[model samples]
Target: MPRLAQPAGSEDAQDPVALLGNLVKASILRYVRSHPGSTIRPICDALALVSTTVQPRLNELEAAGLVTSDPPWAEGTDRRGIVVRYSVNDEAVTDLYLRLGMALGEF
Candidate 1:
């Protein structure tokens, strides 16, 4: 298994790469990567998952430093409130690829 670097002082200190092994997490990452600035509601609609389910996974990805979200005070906002748009961390994705290659002896 590949190890993903965790941010300092992260409460959920588990390996992020290991976390990506989960199908839901992987799908969430893929969706965010493609969508770039998508918010939770659309992700739920696209993935057919409820907010309660997707929100926690998004939180995990953010905590793991694999994804980033614009501040709630940013320009975009829904009727509910500030819509936090998420995007994948390109550096982290690159690191994940490198680590996976190394673990598979493909380096």
Candidate 2:
């Protein structure tokens, strides 16, 4: 079997399943799943988290392919800034669900 690549300085790298074990990350994922196409400001307001605190978690989720976002730099004037909308990747969510279920012997 091939070894999975690990994010530098990430403790969850050894066990991918540990990604879902984080309360903040889990909450962020759930919020993103529930509120697809939400922007950073709304997410921060809804979750009562600061942008600095939530940005890294969003980056991690995006890096792991669990979430996606609009291009940060687009040609349109309306789309030119730090604002990026986010949405959960349904396929990735389902895969995670199945893996978690199987690990828990629920499947």
Report RMSD (Å) for each prediction in the order shown: 7.5, 6.8
Evaluated at residue 89, the lDDT of candidate 1 is: 91
TM-score of each candidate structure, all chains considered together: 0.73, 0.74
Best candidate, lDDT: 2
Question: Tens-digit lDDT track for model 2 on 1-107?
Answer: 54867556544233447656588888888899999999988888988999898987887788788889886322333644656889999899788777776655578
Regions more than 4 Å wrong, model 2: 1-16, 72-80
The count of residue-pair clashes in candidate 1 stands at 0
Candidate 1 C-alpha lDDT tens digits along 1-107: 54855556543323544758588888899999999999898899989999888987887787778888886332343425666899999899778777766655578
State in Å the error of residue 69, model 2: 0.7
> Model 1, which residues run further than 4 Å from truth?
1-16, 72-80
